[model samples]
Target: MAFVIHMPLTNTKAATRYAAELPMRETSPGHYEGYYTATSNVRATGATVEVRAQDDYGNTASEIAKGKLNIN
Candidate 1:
């Protein structure tokens, strides 16, 4: 499934400089992977994973994945 992850933005400067598009990789049919490396080390709180899908006709849709991230 295609997904969008909204990682919390901590550093204002980094947030402002954040890339507008995430470079996604296709793992399988209709599945994609993307990653973000924080400019600084920080913990994640209330993190969530969002999935999106689009058709050749230019129609699109999205949904949030189930689960939480535990970084220690």
Candidate 2:
């Protein structure tokens, strides 16, 4: 089965290192919901937050969601 997940932007800042541990919770069969803090600092003016997921069988998936913070 394929795993589905989503993360809404919780917070954001400019050029600062955003720190937050992703809290992934199993919501349903092959589905999860949580958030992961991006460890990398924002380098440019426009960049989206990306997340990756992997299953026990080594299957992997990724998605790029809108980041909550913006650097001016």
TM-score of each: 0.60, 0.36
Best by TM-score: 1
Give lDDT tens digits, candidate 1, residues 23-50: 5678897667877665556577667777
For all candidates, the clash counts are 0, 1
> What is the alpha-carbon RMSD of candidate 1 to the true structure?
3.1
TM-score attained by model 1: 0.60
Q: How many steric overlaps does candidate 1 have?
A: 0
Query: Model 2 has how many clashing residue pairs?
Result: 1
lDDT of model 1 at position 46: 67
Clash pairs, model 2 backbone? 12-69
* Global lDDT of each candidate: 0.63, 0.48
